[model samples]
Target: MMRMRRKVLCLDWDKRTVRLLVARVGSGRMTLEDAHAHRIPAEVNTDDPAALGGVIAAAMAAHRIRRRDVIVDVPRDKSVIARLPLPPTPIAELPDVVRFQAVKELPFPVEDAALDFVTLTADAERKTATEVLLAAVRKDVLGRIRETCAAAGLRPARIGLRPYANLVSVMHLPGMAERRVLFVDVGPALTEINVVHGGRLAFTRAANVSVPVLGDDDRWQSSRLVVVGGGGEQDAISGAIHDLVVEVVRSLQAYRATESNVVIDNVIVAGHTGVETELAQALEKRLALVTDLFDPTLPLGITGDRGAELRGFSAVLGLAWGLSTRGLLELDFLNPKRVVRRSETIIRRARLLGMAATAAAVGAAALTWSAYRAKAAELADVRKGMEDLRRVVRDARDLTNRSAEWDEWQYDAVWLDHLMILSRALPGPGREVIIRSLVCDSSSSSIRVDLIATNRERVKQFVDVLADLRAGGLPDEPQDSSRPKLYRVEQGSWVEGNTAEPGFSGSTQVMLRVVDVEEFHSPAAVNARKAERERFAREF
Candidate 1:
């Protein structure tokens, strides 16, 4: 089945302005369908949920966007990002590990923070250490964000950090992935300096530096006509740009001290302000690094004056791209709630399917009963003719057999449900174990699964879990003892160096025969099993 393209509205709000971008993302591509910018008055508080919601609603109405799926970029002022090294652990255990690191690194209380992390690197040789990028924002900060978005008649799906969003927006630029570069986003109130090395964020710092306005067009023309006509104004702008460059230089020096092998080759300046060109030129001369104004819209085939304005929406575009492509930054404060909602949706869908199937069965039975009654009436009339009576009996038997065959076909269609069960039976998430391949044969009433794990112990644990699930003992149900066992292990084998993940050293092959096919194939049983499996999947 072809997947439907996602319509996403990305919102970025600062003290001065609220920016909105609506786009359709699918098939590894994103198209900007509409955009809007609303300026907030200084007298009005942007933090006020009602005030902000009004502005967002106006923008959405202007753009004719009714999409409720919104991804928001929160400001960096109240959030913290840290890079930490952890002992080699399974991916499932990273949350606890990150929370521990956050407790030591963050200035605020860990209990009051919403935390997320991305794995940057894992040591394959030793399998003893891993590096991660950790991000945390206070719960209240996120609560306000949610409240504002909610008031706007929008459902906030994901919250992203602005700097990280900027990084993703520019990372795909031509020649950027191959080089270590500094991404300087010069905004109205603050400038973000991000050092990206090897296509990953190595360091980031927000400097409280605003772009300086030089003069009006007439004043600029008069100043160009005479030497030192607007020297003071020019000097002020230059001075401000110099301060930004100084910060960049300090950051570079600090980063170089730790990573001597990687050198920053260039700088990319991006923002909505018109001073970006001047700032880029000034930084190039002062820092001795090749600098250019970053136009993130270039890769999207956008040009002209409007393309320049699109530069301001880079962070929102990045957020949409991440949503479509499942980017590296897997941080989402709303993920747990989303999981619950998704499970509910799945259960509702299952119920609807069950209702439809039952209706179909009832209709089929009604038709068969009417046909049987008519055939019996005809048989009574043809009782005097022996040959006719035998033919009518044969026809009735054939119709009954066809109905039985239809039911059998329905039973065989529960293979997908069995696959769901097998998925639930495995160890997942933070565990290093993964299922490499699954092959189910309804004819043989059997399934074969190939699994990989970081070590042999995890593989053994996986087998035990599968055994428990087959015996209906894994969920600890009181009725499990009476329920029929669903599967019997037919064969098992383990091999080294048969896995794809870098840290995993071995793979296991297991084959199981379906023992209680009747219960597994029942529509109600399948639905219940699927719901339980989905719940387990969410927890892990």
Candidate 2:
């Protein structure tokens, strides 16, 4: 048997077969240099999950290729991606908060889907205050990719979103796009519109800009910089192409009126060079300069044939390219090993929770028996005290039960430090969490909180985000700010990765302190510290 090599196989809805330049280890990237392309014979159903199995089996028999893990790029038309805010690193424990938010966020339901996320902003610190990148691809579309991989005797690892993959490939390539360069991806079933700035995919939206060239193009790129698909219906395509450039120029004009400092140099289109040039010229007439699709020479040293291969599978190729780093998948988003580990973690937590419940029941039974014994002995003393209390209650009737209410309030008091940090980190009313148990040592000021989550993975993610906040030099406000301090998540209990055998285990925790709010505030503040404090505390 040949050694299993990690490979990325991309087959679009149009049956364009592409083997992206991806490696399991070493310098893996996208290169059109070793461009390999083949036409899938119609004898197989491309949409059928099991249909691709025959081809995979055939490839192993013929070429000795025997890898199982696969990454599929879903079609743009069928997928939806939205950019949403992420909480401060500490509050980030609920990473799945975004997933829950996606239901209201996406036009379609995201529950029956396999999703992945990419942090477009390198500085997660900036994200601590607002939103993070959330790209979601529907499960049905992902199933197609999974089906193809399974049929070929391979396991589909992640069905990556198309827009994110394209954005990564576009930004990494040679030359610079405007701060908010409009990205228009004209696919067969749909047209994708996105705005990228600071090398991150920010705003994303799509419309049925495919059928007979009818749809929304308000956010589309300069129509002149068109990326014609294989089904190029000349008139429909050209008209759709022209509309984008017009919108781009109009957007520039509006932007200039408000902010004269901003500059948009030109239009850059990628697809068929022959079809793009005409569109590029149309854009150049109105704007600065109109460029072609993408030049892959930036990351991948493409000379001739290498560059050609990327012309079609740039997005898929880019996803596989980003994965090549660190000897595994980047961001660790929905990776199999990680997924298996995460699933195991969820199971272990469930088991632990059940065990704890059982133990508590047993302990409660024991306490009940002990209390019964104590009650018999205390009955005579309580009767004598009750008789004396009747006289005292008549003297101070209003004070009755007030002591009990005071005791309950004392029990409900949250730790001051957690209260301070959490108040600053709340996700607002529309986004909030109910904290279960927040324990703080009154004397030592040590804090340990336990939160019940819809899933442990979400809790773990929230903790990770909290850690990022301090790392980003964010405020540790309402706490000590003398020499500058930063809060961090102390590692919590983690589960082992192995199923039958155990491997690495991990956990997450949090720490908060007081700080001065000098540079953090402005005289004419857009964000009030007190209001933000309320938002964060609302969750706790």
Candidate 3:
């Protein structure tokens, strides 16, 4: 199937004239169909889009060009152009990194500007940094251009920088890729200089220099020099040409200072200001480099009466042809290409949402764990305080018990009553039994007695008598009526026979409990104490 051809209207303007071209692009080939230049009326305000667009609309109508979608060029002075050197980076990440760096270089706030860039050097194998051409224009400036196009009943498809357009147009010339060339486009008020190195734009700058034209009212005609046989006109033209040359030389010095190894081999000049011939000769003589006038329509076989007039149309022609051949130039401020977000795709968006949810859950779990640990620490502290209080209460109760026991000691017969009980348990005048040791502890309320006897039978008899006295079974002796009565005997009392020595065949030890005689002398108390001792003895 034959591809349908698309027609594009290219528009560019300055304070003097509005330049327009219509081209039909199809099957990778672009043909210029029509071209026209509309000179602004001296009374019409060029700054007003409504007034300027009326001239553009009338020009389009007069040229018989009906293409509505146009590609526009912003003058070099209207946009800020910069060449940024960046670290070696991948193509996918270049846009973001370039924008980040471009923000720092811009004179105005980035938010109010439209930005775009093209990478000039992106060789990963060279291990060298990447260089990109960055272009930014204020949104308000572009808005005015859009308003102008709209007023002309045209829709702007792309807004591109004029310097890059000139660069693209010049690169199409034969043998420009391998050599470094300085491209100069001289305008009435502003002149643009572009440095093309290795088929890429390296540097660009605009200067404020005006070229004098003889016929100021000659609308849409080639600019001609006024030689009225007068030195006054000649001197003024020569002075303007000299100023243009000086600006070109300064631009060359700047480019060379930065890239000393890359020497500019040729100077290509493009302008309709009839002085291009004079300017090229001056640059060649002053800078000592080959210089030539750039005719953009020549390569496309566009010549004849219209070719000379189209010398100044190189930037607009390049803007149209570059879009046709390359689909889209690297720099497109109308709709700039940016990094694609993963969240733009549904599957990637779902994954990102899942990751966010997982992070939130983990954070909540961490907070909950921290709260639990804090509460646990507080509970432990409370338990410790309770335990300390319990210890203090126990100590106070122990002190009370010790004080009551001390008071009992003052009223009771101290150790004398205990000695009397032990004497009564002895066999009369050492008849086969001998007392060995007697110990009494008033604080603990107990007595321990040790005895030696001739045989185990004598030891048994002495223990039996002590037990009987504690139970009140033995009759009190008449001589000791004032002695305290025996109240208790401990079940721990026992006798063991020792046959290791011939003199002592057995040994005995008895343990007795001291108590208040009046308090425990009742029959019921005595019987209750006897039952407890018997039960203990039986268990032992």
Candidate 4:
């Protein structure tokens, strides 16, 4: 539990004193830092348009108090009130049911009644007990008070019945130490009596104080506290006190029989304008129970600079204590409209952001994984390509080395001498004038020779030489065909120029790629292309 400090303003219309108590309940001590109490003006006309509750307001201002919880006692002449029954239902659903019940129960109709309920307790069976206090004050009385409080800069957070408040406050004294206690508050005209047994309020009754008794006594300080409301002449006051004491003795006797579990040990009197010693002595004279004056800072457990000052201001202290509980009394003192709306908005925003963040994280993870896999695949492909290229380069290097070691000079002389030999092997040479350029394509294993010729008949001699070479077992095909067959030749147009001879201006080119061939030394055909080329060359 956290430390609790609150400024409470209290007014007893009977006593006509406005009391300010700033009390803090902490470390098992109630410290009263400041205390201010003031008497009301005799002829202030509290019922006037601007007169009601003015004295208490002035005390608040004197203390420079701007905000506080005020607990004010109603005068004796005021009879307007309401009480509601609460049970067989939950505490949270009380307001709706209160509205429904008050409509019929309140003779003035529910709308005219200002209703507020304080739930006393709820047993384990879901049976709730509530005290619904309805004030049926004159509209003018409320309007005047509202204007006065507003002008005084006092915001009345809770307006409660004086009798109920006194009862509740007296029950929470430092250490009264009684399972069953009696709380009696005497006002100017009416006296309120309450019995709190088993830590819950059992009864509340209001009676007229026909004879008032004023005393200064210290005996009323235990389970029972007498509250003598202040007013009247000396005779009037003395008579009121006697009448109150008699009634109090009868109540204790009746309670002991009805509730056999409880014991009445002591009587404590809380005076409005009276003393404790005189009141305590008078009570002991008539009743068998011991009597004492009420001192709320009792049991002497508290230690602080202001502990003594806060004892009398228990009503205001009770107001703060009431706030410390969760879901205690259902009062509209707290404006919950703004709180509920803000909470729902915050929760909705947080939920939306949480879902969006989850989805984004999942998507980013998937993309990152995909990129990693793609890079791995690309690296594998590059590695395979490099390995194949390395093999190719190694094979080419081996082939170059072998060629270099075997007959390098002879190979150069016969390097492309085969093309020249083929040209010379043509029958009836000198038809085609010369071979211009020969290109050997190793990729396709084909040889192509460009020829500049003088006559078309020289092409026929070239074709005959190719036929003879093919029959001698060189790879061959028919020389002339419509298609460009393998090992076949095609003649280009005559070279554009002077017609040295009819149709003898252009060159012819032969293109072939051979995969199989025959050796000329086999003698399958004499004067093979290879041999015939040597013979022609010899003649030239």
Badly placed stretches (over 4 Å) of model 3 are 124-129, 218-232, 304-306, 341-346, 355-540
What TM-score would candidate 1 get against the native? Answer: 0.58
Please report, in order, the local distance difference test score of every candidate based on alpha carbons. 0.69, 0.48, 0.72, 0.50
Per-residue C-alpha lDDT of model 4 across residues 1-540, encoded as one tens digit per residue? 112234455443443444555544333334444555455555666555356456656666666666545444343234254456655655556666666766766556555555555554455575554555443443454455456566555666655455445555555664553445566554445555566554444555566665333332322221123344444477766666677777777766766655577665555555454533554677778766666555554433344433434434544554444444443222332221112233344445555555654555555556677765665565555555555555654565555556544433332233243564465555444544566677875444456766656666676567555544431122233333432222344445555445444545766676644322212112453245446445544542
Minimum summed lDDT over a 10-residue window in model 1 is located at: 218-227
* Per-prediction TM-score to the true structure, in the order listed: 0.58, 0.49, 0.62, 0.48
500: Cα error in model 4, Å: 99
Best of the two (2, 4) by TM-score: 2
Candidate 1 lDDT by residue in tens digits, 1-540: 112356788899766567787788765667777766555555657879988887778767766778887899766676898889887866655677778877899999999988877778876665434888888889999899888888889988888888778777777677787677798877767778888867577888888876543322221111012112222366667777788888788878878876787767888887655567778888888878899777655666565445556656667877876766755446666652111233344445555555654555555555677766665554444443444444554565566557656655655665675665666656653468787788888766678887788888876765665565533233232335455565677546668895767888888788877666545465786687568545644543
Of 2 and 3, the candidate ahead on lDDT is: 3
lDDT of 3 by residue, 163-214 (tens): 8888778777778867888999988788899998675787888999877654
Q: What TM-score number comes out for model 2?
A: 0.49
Superposed model 4: Cα runs more than 4 Å off? 1-12, 25-30, 52-54, 61-87, 120-145, 174-178, 210-234, 246-265, 299-314, 324-540
Error of 2 at 49 (Å): 3.9
**Once model 2 is optimally superposed onto the true structure by TM-score, how far is the C-alpha of residue 359 displaced, in angstroms?**
14
